[model samples]
Target: MDTRELEGFLAQHAPFDSLDAKMLRSVATAATVITFPRGEQILDAFTDPTNAVFIILSGRVDIWNDADRLREAADESLSAGELFGFSAMLTERSVGPRAVAATPVTIARVPAAAVAPVFASRPGARFLAETLLSTRHQALAAPAYSSVEELITTAPLTVEPTTPVSEVARLMTERDSRYAVVPGPDHTFGMVTDSILRRRVLVEGLPPATPAREIMQPATATAVVGESAQEAQITLLDHGSDFLVVTDRAGELRGVVAPRDFAVSPSTAGVALNEQLRRAGTAEELDTLARQAPKMLADVLGRGLPSGRVIAVYSSIVDTIVRRAIQLTFQRHPDLSTEAFTWLALGSNGRREAVLSSDVDSAVAFVDGTPPDEITRYRAVFAEVDEMLVGAGLMSDDHGASARRTLFARTNADWRAQATRWLAAPTDGNGAMMTSLLVDGRPVHGDTGLPEVARVFSDLRRHPGTMRLLLQESLSSRARLHSMRQVLSRRNDTFDVKTYALVPVVNIGRWAALSVGSAALPTTERLRVAAGSAMLPRSQASTLIEVFETLQRLRLRYQLLQIREGIRPSDVLVLDRLSAIDRTVIAQAVREVSSIQRRMANVSNYVPTADWSSTDGL
Candidate 1:
């Protein structure tokens, strides 16, 4: 490849985005361009990996493992700006061993060595590396967060502009609504609210037969169907309306955006965080906003979200809030670039299922460069903000997210090396440690490009022995599915309930997903996403998730009972307070545990050797 081509290619990756003219020229002056053809492997597991990560100049790369060629174990293709060998680079112990190639054209390899030193001196380099190290299969331009379709309150009240006022009131009452839409023949809408009923018809001395449009508010607030709920919030706030009519791209009315509905909706916390980020000027302000997250979920639950989905939604919001807070921290400290760094959220926070009183697990990710001096300064800033977040009500993780836990964060190269060692030779004792965090981790915040880090983590989990170990360790802790007699009635006397029962299912689903590289944020989600080729089918997976949810809700309800009674509750429970139906559900959940345990026993050869390698753990 020529100089012009090399510069163009490197320009497309991160770090280059924020590089000043002088730095850009410096990068251009010291880049090497390599070429590959279709089907040629650019890298593999056996290469003597270096600290430098690879950036695809162009074309597609297939990630396959001949050791286990099953569709369950391999990804068919990766495209432009997607990175490979990043895990190899990040892991200080063992380099990542994934292949790359040309779809039909040439590709380029930019050594982290050349720009790495310069990058280390620059905050942008740390940001770039952090982005890559986030999950080990880290990429160059991964999506910022897991994006999902927006849900809206689509079924709304409707009426014609010519409707009578008294009839409008009847329509509202019949539909159990306080507002209704009155659309003109041309499709323009006006709103008829409960307030209008009293003022326009009753107080104004207008006849009950007056046309609806006459009594309705003429100034209508509207939002497009795809517009974010935050936009809807602002529209309502700006127009002094309780709801905004949501229209489609073609301008047809799609639905109504109610303030209550938008505020209480699940998973759209990103919309709110995005808005907050746009207006944030300081990290302290962002920290203040994060404290409001739990209450928001508590309110959503009050609005009728099921206990399980409520936890998922609630945790999702908190993750987004904390993520934005970190982003704001980076913005405030321009000396610390997010581009070279990957931020890891740990423990309950990592899982996206935090309760109102939960702790945070987090670390800073950087790239391994020629000089150790490269990331030291950014590390100082990372230390400062890490402590700041703790003081802000996110308790420190019990598992020690503190730096005392041996530089728990590393560059893409360092992390990949460690993940490789844990995967290839994971001891029975600590096998669950690194991979546990990986399963709950969603890039709730920070560089999405680091999915490669996760890939590496998951790939290592494919080790059959680790599966056997996890299966054994987890099932040993399972509560009896059903006692010969009553179960929870004898809780502390029977099972600890919280750690012994729930954690097994949690860890089981987590290990299963890690073994297959499922990119799901929660254990329930992991089970669903991994059902395709897992030993369990979709129905079994659903049942497991259902059981897990039942257990969690039971725990939550017990807590609520304690709070209500001023009992100063613990997770231990009494089955007596539960409805007959709930008791039956718990019994069924216990039965599911039994089934999982039996299956685990078979997989583990519980009778003897307990061989965990079923098709190389795929």
Candidate 2:
């Protein structure tokens, strides 16, 4: 093989593609070409152990089920531009699927040592880590269940929206399934669960012949194939749903997983902890359950879960505790329930990214037409609710963002009016900060249908003034560094990770998401959607997402360590204390943020139009 041609081929594949010219040449020089005839096995579990990475250059390769060549695992085909044998070579283990050439195949065999330079590069290392370690990447030790794919026990029972309720129920019964997916024409879907049947049909005296669409409930929670099981568990815990409708990468129906699946695996104690939170009868009991969360966080982190997933698991459990506290409050004063309201988790909690030391940022959105007296009573109830949460170890927002503050709690109509005022007058100082926080608000409890404020923010995509304000805010928070190169600690060798690193990415992601009219709440999802819509370059978005994860993991690990040492957990980390590798990682992540901010400065001038057609010149 021509060395230059091999270099070109290697330059097109990821991890390898990120290699510099000199590194690429060295890798190309070290690579050797090997050919296999059709029906020949390349690597087998117990024979022909893989010693190098194999990139298919031509023709096809088939990877069979682990330890056996009897059948192929679902969708396990490798064509040109795909690679295999890397996992075996990286882990230095002769274990994995038997790879067989489906046709006359030419492969570029690159020894693991040849690609060591690629592994040292940021993008290359990230790709390797994600591909090899998976998302359970060593922030945690070993989770009981890693991905949602692990919990899938059966294929989804899909039905047309117009299918008769009786027929749907019969199909579910025949399959012994608890839910049936109702796919819509617009690539959306809903579910008709057994619980829906019992409550909406039987109890409501609806006819069995009613169209499934009439009784189908909107998807309460969903997960994509390959999503972490801990993430799926969080969805279940927060939504109080029986099952999560699983979808493939293309948003096609895949399968469903339930809480019962977690019950069986019992790897982490999250599900059990949530159950205790749910069953707690008093504030004291709830506080006790809440105190156990740190240990659970440590266990999750020990199991190799990433920081984002770890925070999500902890935050979801906290959501349950908050809801239970509200329930306990309601039990004491049932009259407060007479006024319909939605409890909104704002800021970090709303984004499901809170840490052990994070403050409670909350608000209350009452339904229109509630009496003035009842509104006052609702405020008092939330005050007690705040006290309970504080007793449970969460700190109240020192800025008075909690629902207990009258300024933060308002009727749906009032909230909408405030949002309009904020958007129209983007220069208002208080409104600008509030708008930033309010965009992250999500319903964690109560009616869960506060649409007024959402409607106001929905127009933000076309609101240039507000979009500029948000964009400016996103760029304002800079990573603490000396001359924009060396990471700098501010006080006593300590740096506020949340303030300097995490919050800037969060702000940038939120702005990017809103600019693209994306409704995604999580920062990662926001970055992803923004990239998909061309609002930001895909590679840049991926970099920011990686940086966010890196900093988040650092903060969570430091706080957990503090708690273990009997010190109060805080976002401020002592830079002098981090390991050499960790300190270097922080410096690299900080530089990445600096680079993104510089790039985003150009985007401040571009604006979305009424139709949301522009990509903000990103």
Candidate 3:
């Protein structure tokens, strides 16, 4: 490569631009020359190929490979100002644009080892690296949250100096937290974690002979105290710690802060809902306002609340919103008050498995002999509130909603008519199917005196009834899967992810809930509430929740990653991108769902298992 050509090229990119004439010459002098024929496939998506930075001289290049082929060709053609194959030059992988000459091309190759000097000399190099690291940088919208700190919680956790590791572990367990900071003899603190036990005692074969100080992370990494939850989250992310200890002005630890504490922070969902409940005037306003439940759910999950508390906090928030929404609706349509009523929370919201952006699955009810005006009030309020939610970007379930038909109505007569028509008239043909969606509903607001509704649902379920019919509808759709527990992909390709692996768990949960008139829709809680009493084994119930949550987390993480990548967030996850561990977990989750579905099928439909795994495993 000519020294002048190298000087001109180095001067163009910022990190490189800062180089003096002498250094530029040095770079150009040391630069190796690599030439290629007019065409080449440089890298695969999953693997990196090059070990040097590529600078184009006389020829052009194309980027992409069939495997890591981000593009079939140079998705964006590079000219003199543009650097191509830089990732290959910078790192030990096949990365970046596959520099294929549009015609015969001349290029400069800078060894990977030398790239760091350019970075060290010019901070701009760091920016360039990150920019190239992500291809679709233009599409990455600013984060919705105000700051990154809003999601981390590296607050220091401290305990009394006398607290032993056993007691520390007990506190951590009771709090469902992982790490604890122990009180120090001085102002400095000692810490304890399960990792210490595993690494020191178990792995090193050492006894509990050493004090916790031998292994504790220094408190220096945690928040100083009184910082916002956002700052706490940042401290945690920066420190990779889960628990934080809040201190007072004097620097004495006052309380322990964990992910859950941050999630239920006063300024966010819990506080906002509390404030709204006081100010809300009409039921329609309340319901419309409740759309923030998803926002709160996002915040809860964003703060990295653990699974159980995440579910618990989110459920409580949704329940609060539902009640508040209904209360405001009634205020606006006072005539609905004539009859005792219940606002049933169906589907995920009912069972406490609510997530951000889930839909509204609910119906209204009144005592059997409701007056016509009450029905009008209830219907009108629901209509207004439902439309408000749609306008606010909160979706309603697909079966139907308050906007269409007479879905939100008053009276047990109305519900009875709907349920009876589905079971008896069966004209809808999708009766058992639709009923399953409705069956998991638990009253959220109004005169939640809904035992009658539960009884009616349970009776129909036990009869020559909807239980088997619902089971068949759900299972038949999932039958003929290629693997016993795996989602059967399509004949051409396998996208049977949600249909086979996820829905079955949810449907079985619905059936179980209906069988017991469970007060919840979420499979886990329904199973929990119904355990022993509903003839459900506690262990099985717990396992089912784990299965459900695993699927839910996978789906959630997939969506979050898409959002990060500037890809459209969709339920259709690209399985190839998942880690090997994640893929295995997903497969296991799917299989668990399958096993539970199989058990439910055999039990409900009296189908004899050809093999023993279904029954014996259960």
Best by lDDT: 2
Instruction: Work out the TM-score per prediction.
Output: 0.50, 0.68, 0.47
RMSD of model 2 against the true structure: 18.0
Cα lDDT, all candidates:
0.58, 0.75, 0.54
Off by over 4 Å in 2: 1-142, 152-219, 247-255, 266-269, 447-451, 482-492, 532-539, 598-618
lDDT of 3 by residue, 184-241 (tens): 6555655566677567667877544455566576655455544555455444422334
lDDT of 1 at 502: 72
Candidate 1 residues 479-504, lDDT tens each?
A: 56444444546433333355646777
**Candidate number with the higher lDDT (2 or 3):** 2
Q: Which is the winner by lDDT between candidate 1 and candidate 3?
A: 1
lDDT of 3 at 583: 73
Candidate 1 stretches with Cα past 4 Å from truth are 1-288, 327-334, 370-380, 402-405, 460-462, 474-476, 480-497, 532-534, 537-539, 557-584, 606-618
Q: Candidate 3 versus the native: TM-score?
A: 0.47
